[model samples]
Target: MQTISSCVEAIVLEQPFLEEALSKGIINYSALADVLQDDVSQTLGKPVKAGAIMMALRRYKDRLTVSKPYYGLNALLEQLGDITLRSNLSDFTFRNSNTLIDSQAAILNTIKNKSHIFYTFTRGILESNIIISSSEKEAVLESFKNENCIALKENLSAISLVLPKHNTKVAGLYYQILKRLAWQNVSLYEVISTTNEFTIVVEDTFVDSAFSIIKNLNKN
Candidate 1:
């Protein structure tokens, strides 16, 4: 049955900002109920009272209050293992091809002896990207000379995070960290993550602000 409670939940779930406000108990329930009265009435196929909608919202707020969406996540942010930065990097993206794997091997083979270089590669269905120190950019370009180069971004930096081991078990772990960075207007070029590591590649100019924002997410 499409009861008032169920309708209110449906509406709240569809609006993430409203749900956040409800969880934080920052919104006025009566006013919101007045706004949602018509929607609830239409959903229930009856004229729902504002007072009844307000009661449902109140109950929803109570439930949201008791449920911690990010329980035990703050401490994990506070204890981020290591926030390392590698600067003066270049991002090369090329359309995928059969010889792509051979080029990757050649690039690795060329830079194998350069222990000071930092590099990471990711292959997608349609494209592949290679991030490497500017010092090794020439070798990557030489290796991929025959491939279709789609994009090349230079003067970038990467911030790598050692995520908590239990990160996969916790919900909203990435959202909580990325939300703060978004709020600060930090622009991300690429985001890469694994089971226990997360990396954010950004313009060199924004690295400090992004680093500061991520380093202190727990304080906020």
Candidate 2:
């Protein structure tokens, strides 16, 4: 039989948003008990009352709050540069092939002069997904026209946030930035992560909103 304490722990662990709310003391215990009573009983294969669940929640409240404070997070945010927006972007995906391997140098040389370029080479067991992004659509098309391209997507835009180098060991920094964007219903076409910076590519229409959403991460 699963104890109430163990079940509460499992619930908090599985639900990140709920864990955050509980840690921040913003979660209504009565509502949480009401919501989880059925699930807990089903999991335990018995009838568990809401009052018992609430008591268990209170007993494990401290254990449920497990958020770690990232030191120097504010200092790193202060060093963030202004958001840079680029338009008229294009994304190209090429199938994995020997020809694709030989064509990489030519394609890179073609877009080397563009204002901005994002290149990702993802290899799978059977194939690969090669993504190349640049502002020069015509040049990109011209370079890859003869290659074995499995897909091509265009009319994309990029919003890059240049952050200062923070401790990589610190947790939840990326989560904080991504969670804010998610809450605003911003869809990311792609994300390029680095040691000190993170860039997200979105459609031209959402560029303004995405930038605003990311910039607000520093406020809290």
Candidate 3:
């Protein structure tokens, strides 16, 4: 049995994500505590220790992004299979020898045989694919289609932005913006952030709401 205080300390110190949550600015610690308890209990399939519960809350505190709410037409459309969601993926292709080589000998053999055979390593850029998204939004939603929508070829359409390093301020601003937009039933394909600005990809129909949310936040 871990003391609640110790649990909190352990969580705060162990997880980098806790800080990420705090930067978003809208998290309530008490509410987050409940969510953490549920998560840990679910993961363990039994009641978690008091310390673990405390740790969960502390862990959540430092997170930069939180889940968004979905409702309205977009929600209905999703249930009806009318919308498509693009997911962020990590894909890689590597070329190596067909022969079985063991440990150091393999590395030495590969290096030695480097000139005799062609070994190619290929990787995909950290970019989102648009082909996975549905075209229904584009046909019926005029506002979504015309708004500076850049095509990444195939079927993917995106609006990209750059942000500075993964710091509190930068994470907080974007997290707040995306959360609100998502609540308005805007389904973002991806929200990718680097050391700087963040980029979000949404279905065409949700673009109007997304724009409105951003504009409203700016005014505030």
Per-model TM values vs. the true structure: 0.85, 0.82, 0.33
Cα lDDT, model 2, residue 93: 64
Global lDDT of each candidate: 0.89, 0.72, 0.42
Report residue 13 deviation for candidate 2 (angstroms).
Answer: 2.4
Candidate 2: stretches off by over 4 Å: 64-67, 70-82, 115-135, 146-148
Q: How high is the lDDT of residue 156 in model 3? A: 29
The model with the greatest lDDT is 1
Candidate order, TM-score descending: 1, 2, 3
Best by TM-score: 1
List candidate 1 stretches off by more than 4 Å: 14-17, 30-53
Q: Of 1 and 2, which scores higher on TM-score?
A: 1
Minimal lDDT window, size 10, model 1: 68-77
Q: Count the backbone clashes (under 3 Å) in each candidate.
A: 0, 0, 18
Global CA lDDT computed for model 2: 0.72
Model 1 agreement with the true structure over 1-220: per-residue lDDT tens digits: 7799999999999976688778878898889988999999998999999999989998988888778656577667766778899999999999999999999999999999989898999999999999999988889989999999999999999999998788787777787767678778899999988899999999999999999987877785
Candidate 1 lDDT at 107 equals 96
Q: Model 3, range 62-176, lDDT digits (tens) per residue?
A: 3323432322223322222112223332211122322212222333343453453211112224321222223322321232232223333223234444332333332245555
